[model samples]
Target: MLLSPTFSILLLQAASSLAIPGSVVKRADPVVQLDDTTVTGIANGTVNQFLGIPFAQPPVGSLRFQLPRPLPSYNESFPATAYGPVCPQQAFNLTIPSDLPAETQEVLEVMNSGSTRTISEDCLSLNVIAPANASVGSKHPVIVWIFGGGFEAGDPAATDGSVIVNKSIDLGVPVVYVSINYRTKVLITLAFGFLAGKEVQEAGIGNLGLQDQRLALKWIQRYIGQFGGDPSKVTIWGESAGAISVALQMVTNSGNAEGLFRAAFMQSGSPIPVGDIAHGQVYYDSLVNQTGCSNSSDTLKCLRGVPYDTLMDAVNNTPNIFSYQSLSLAWLPRVDGIFLTDDPQQLVLQGSVADVPFVTGDCNDEGTIFSFANLNVTTDDEFLTYIQMYYTPGASVDEVKQILDLYPQDPADGSPFNTSDQNALTPQSKRLAAFQGDAIFQGPRRSFLQQRAGKQETWSFCNKQSKALPYLGSYHGSDMESIWGDGAMSDYFLRFVTNLDPNGNTSINWPRYTLDSPNMLTLLDGSIPLQITQDDYRVEAMRGVSGLMLKYPL
Candidate 1:
């Protein structure tokens, strides 16, 4: 998704509405034959976009909580010129803290500015944008994108992939781009894509969003060649929740790539330290009771029968990304015995990780944006209690104390890292920002890379742009424009997708990250736009957080 320069909007609508009066005429729409179906796509200058093509059958009715089922066949013509309806979003009614900077408050509101598109249960669709001239024999490398909205909201329409497609053409490494729409929290299956508890566990239907993505990958493998893409050279990429999805996809199915993708590029996400689907039993029960399914023997079936609006109202009442609970989401991916056999961190430790070449990184202050929800946590006692109650309930007192010692209360030592003694807002605000940033974003990413360093080719980056933003620093999702808006990151991404390495033809040599060297491509905003640095900031703190996460999986 492309954020506007002022950060006033999280997703900039596509510029397809622009008009040039009589000077511009619509080009003939491009057509591709997929099996027996004739698919028509909009011809947008040098790129042709095939939008809203369903890869799986409509996941409505009895299919609400079940795993995605591939469409048996494509026997009809499709006008793939517009995006389909998005899965129902779990709305966020969080209030911005009055103590925060006005700018920070505006940004918080902007981040939660949800989409205006139609919402429906029949939203398992994928989109493709390829060179206008790409024929069946073109065989270009393909990059599939998974959007990030904290796993509660998002859709394919949030991003305009043609930017990357056009950039690839300009870079002389033309490639195809694809984005998918998967069910989010409001699916009628109690949690739609991420329903949990023993019922979902025994049924083996957890992580349905990831399942939807998997099905989309399978669809691409079977049909992308018709759109001039080489199925064997596919790269899966995403940001935030989408990035976490990429990491989980890498480790799931016992690390098997399943011939779906050969590479991955993740930003601001990693395999989180979450336990089994049963861990979400409380939330599942709450949904059941709220949706009037508590009396039913088969709650899953009862939920499926509930009216869509009623179920959505119950889902919306749960904790969202912006709620006081923050990143402790009510609905998210978990270790289902079938799709995800173990805790993601445990899976990594057991060496159940794909050997695909990949790139993963994060912004400098990933937690500041999320810290707004906890503005009331001022005193040190409140901070410690909050961590124990919400973040790591399983950690022993000594371990939580160790975490507190590592992440001190001094504002100078807090996030907006170098600003020192500034942007505090409240006594514990900066402290919480530092700890949360490392615990969730920085710590997990470092651990994932360190564990898989030598096993496969790897590269890492730290986006430090917008470092001066008050209270928020270079907040989460800040680096989006660099990749999606034709910045240098886009060039690096295209290079990585096409060659399995991000170095060729790039202005700077992005060295591979290794255990001993741990190089990170640091993105800056000044005269030195880029620099190579060791990924060694807060080593002890991050290591402590990683250990705590393993011991107390969220």
Candidate 2:
């Protein structure tokens, strides 16, 4: 499909206005002129960075729960030198298992340290990092990154793009890197960005965060060429919540790419078995009651008028990813009739996904970290009740029993797989971990691949690099280091971003994933760092779990 005239005008202005002649200015700092604004960037040896550029109008005041609007044009010039404030993050009071190793805690803390930046509702900005000498019309492949924090907490600054850019430079495949910020939880007296219910669905304002991401992609299509990038060859990449966001982006708009991104790269996330937006009525009502908006006829409007501190307090009191509910998040993306026409997994089954080449993978034990919040469920009866209440709400006793049979209570058969009976903090800890990981992460990924394998190009991997870590084997988000550092996976990713295939001039070629030959590029911990293996570890169990989740959408 071709771009509209308005986008064509924006693209022409962004490219022509930004083309600077060599003799015009001689300085260490790099600069690009777009529309009427002049952007000055920092010169860091291998890459030049332009940070904190606004892509959308600030979503504040009356625009609180509304979809993001793209910026019309820039009127003034500003120094794009430092990162902007991050969107407000939802607070979670979690209790990590006391028996967890100190090293594990340190790793988790380091991963989250970047989110300590100041936060604000006016944060709808993005960052760009390009090779040092990249100029207009250079046509470098663009990689847009989205950070992940379970859709509740995360910032664009969480991962550094310098590692990937620098490595690409060394490998003779230069590329441009971009990361964007979107609303998460709101602090002011208003419905959260992900608020859901009949009112929200009717207003067509649910999943505001996802809407924010879509607008950013449109912004990229209009302006990325100014930074010497080929918007036509753009790739959308993310991990965890960001990965889930990427998957949703692929599946939304009736599987249309809309000339925004040409490919996708996901880590630890896929199209989940989530149902209708109306399913979140309880949380929406709770927010309305806590904000004292139940008395008003226009409750949504009343929520918009609530005080900031009161709204923040109510949002804080809700169940977060670390709550006893674990993966059942309170403020999350749902099937809002407009943006998401149906459940994500159902969309995949209906063939409503973008026909693009992509990569999706997970860590060996993607459940252990989330299992910590449910340490109270020590007995078999308590475990059954917890599962029935949270996951299998409408499932019968026989169906739930069938699920239990597939995932036995024996710790030896649970997560941190192959480590027999060692890391069960409670009697049901590992067992619950296995189930949650499959339900939320593994099962959805496998199902998505099986459905889309022959239809489009696909590749998958399993990161077991940190399998030696105590309770949390190769836990969720552990592969982040490899992508953000000068590691093997980093090279593979660079190859993918530049060539669309993660194999070229390398001995170990990554084969495309298919239903008949379900191959995986496994990252391990021994002297041999990488190997090819079948993605058939828990075939029958995963099939049973996927079927149950399809019947009982979360």
Best by TM-score: 1
Candidate with top lDDT is: 1
Tens digits of per-residue lDDT for model 1, 109-151: 7786777889899999999999998999899999999888888
Predicted structure 1: clash tally:
0
Off by over 4 Å in 2: 1-27, 108-114, 187-191
Q: How many clashes (backbone atoms < 3 Å, residues ≥3 apart in a chain or on different chains) does model 2 have?
A: 0
Clashing pairs in 2: none
Compared with the true structure, what per-residue lDDT tens digits does model 2 show for residues 213-246? 8998998899988999999999999888888889
Residue-pair clashes per candidate, as listed? 0, 0
311: Cα error in model 2, Å: 1.4
Minimal lDDT window, size 10, model 1: 1-10
User: For each candidate, what TM-score against the reference?
Assistant: 0.96, 0.93
Residue runs of model 1 more than 4 Å from their true location after superposition:
1-25, 98-102, 187-190
Candidate 1 has what TM-score? 0.96
Model 1 RMSD in angstroms:
2.1
